[model samples]
Every structure is written in structure tokens, then in C-alpha cells.
Target: MTDDRTQDAPVEDQHPQPIDDKVAGILVQEEADLAGHDQAEILEALRQRFADAGIAISEDELLEQSVRIAGADGGDFSDR
Candidate 1:
């Protein structure tokens, strides 16, 4: 029997890193900064950041991740 998994699989196929203390702190800061911003603005900002970081992400995917992060931070998005 031989292993079938390829060693050169795309990074996207790997599971994302688990959120730790450092990530938690970053999330808190991001949540604070995003407070009072509308969803469209937030999504735009995040998309720009991702592009600057050389990451390719669709607007919808970025928005989904942003909402997930906000929810994890116990944020109230109703205001914006």
C-alpha cells in the first residue's frame, strides 16, 4: 500500500489554524475598529487588506468570514 495524499496540495486545502490568544486579541481589536461601520464598508476594507496581503478572496467570501469573526467576538452588527 502507498500513500495517495500529495505533498504539494494547495495551501487552501489545509485546515485553517485554530484561533489562539494572539488571534483572539487581533479579533478584539478588529471588532473595535469595525464598530459602527456598515457591512459594505467593512467588506471593502477587508477585501483591500486581503489584496494587500496577496490573498485572493471574493467579496462574498470575505464578507462571510468577516461576519463569522464578528459573531465570534460577540459583536452587535445591527447598528451598521
Candidate 2:
């Protein structure tokens, strides 16, 4: 007998670009909404959100990504 799981796998595994694009779109859309929020609160919220999505990311990683995203948007987070 042959394994059948491969036939039931999601197409996303074969085409992950769209999924990545969608995630980026979501982050961009939420960027404005995140402004003025406490940095720690935002980090915790992001950590929880990613955890809920079954993704694991450290606080430092989240902070680094947050700074990078802010910089890309012409914002300064050095004071944080």
C-alpha cells in the first residue's frame, strides 16, 4: 500500500510566495495601527499572535524585526 498523505497536502507548500505576500500585506496594513502603542505591549501582542499561528519567535527577534519595519517606513525607533 502507498502512503496517501502527499495527495492531500496543501498547495501552499508548492507555492509559498503568495502566502508570504499576504503576510507582508497584513504587516504593512497593521503598521499604521501600531504607531503610538507601547513598544513592549506591541512586542508581546506580536509574540502572542505568532504563537497562535504556530510560529515561534524570540522577543529579541521581534524587536529587531519591529525596528527594521519601522525604519523601512521612515520611522525612528531608537528611543524605544
Candidate 3:
């Protein structure tokens, strides 16, 4: 049988464009820990961190990456 998860999950890039996957996850997690899991806050945190590092990233790209990295409560991302 086909895996339901594969069907439902958004295809992720092999590597994040602006930063590393591990680094993105750490940033996402830290923002959540500090700000209580609000998507906007996490996204802003990611945007700011990348900016501070002199990495140019688009808002659309960051939002998409954040969903994969942060995941909603009980969402597919967290399961992985």
C-alpha cells in the first residue's frame, strides 16, 4: 500500500536555499520555545536570523520552509 504520509506531505527541497535544514530547524524550535508556537512569530524569527547572517531570503520561501520545519500541532512534520 502507498504510504499516506508521502501522499499528503509537501515535497521538501533536498536542502533549504537560504540556510541548512538543521540550522532552520534549530531556529524554528528556539522561536517556538521562546514565543509559544505562533507561526507568525516563528516566521519573523527565521527571517530576522537569516537577515542578521546576511542571507537573502524571500518571505514566500521562508513561510513554506517554516511549515515544514515547525509543523502544526499533531501535523505530519512533527511525526517525522
Candidate 4:
């Protein structure tokens, strides 16, 4: 599925990339691990993981549902 949110954005293809299924699995595993932790801990862990992976995502922006699910009311999914 194409995401309308990013569909209109331009991507810089600076390098050739190869498909790696392992990377996809790792991401899924990270989300599963996050699901088992509290909101705060999950966010911290996610931030740390992102840093380790050389991905930049600040706590303020990372706190969004895409990285962690809030336990408020019916809960808000990061829609990531």
C-alpha cells in the first residue's frame, strides 16, 4: 500500500539498496518488544534503539503513536 502521507514527498535516491528481509523482521521484533513495556520505558527504549541503528528521532517526535502506543482513553496508535 502506498501511504498518502509520504506519497507526495520526494525521495533522494543517493545509493542503490538491496532488499533485506532480516531488517524487516528486526523492526517487527522491536515493535513487539515495545508492546511489552510501559509507555515511558517503551519510548526510552525506542529512542535508544533508533540511535543505535543510526536513525535520528527525538523523544518529543518519537513519542508519537508510530513508535509507542499511549494508554490514554481508547489509546492512540502511532499509525506508523
For each candidate in the order shown, give its overall lDDT on alpha carbons.
0.56, 0.56, 0.58, 0.51
Clashing pairs in 1: none
What ranking of all candidate models by TM-score puts the best one first? 2, 4, 3, 1
Deviating ranges (above 4 Å) for candidate 1: 1-29, 68-80
Q: Over all chains combined, what TM-score does candidate 4 have?
A: 0.45
RMSD of model 4 against the true structure: 12.4
TM-score of 2: 0.46
lDDT of 4 by residue, 2-67 (tens): 766654433523443432442344345556555545777766666676676555555576676333
List clashing residue pairs in candidate 2.
none
Better of 2 and 4 by TM-score: 2
Strongest candidate by TM-score? 2
lDDT of 3: 0.58
Please write out the lDDT profile of model 2 over residues 31-79, one tens digit for every residue: 5556556666666666666766455556776886565454444343222
Tens-place lDDT digits, model 1, residues 1-80: 99898868658346555435333444355556775556666666676665654556566766775775445434552322
Considering summed lDDT, which 10 consecutive residues are worst modelled in model 3?
A: 71-80
- Residue 68 displacement in candidate 4 (angstroms): 4.0
Comparing 1 with 2 on TM-score, the higher-scoring candidate is 2
RMSD of each: 9.6, 7.5, 12.8, 12.4
How far does residue 40 in candidate 2 sit from its true spot (Å)? 0.7
Q: Please, what's the RMSD in Å of model 3? A: 12.8
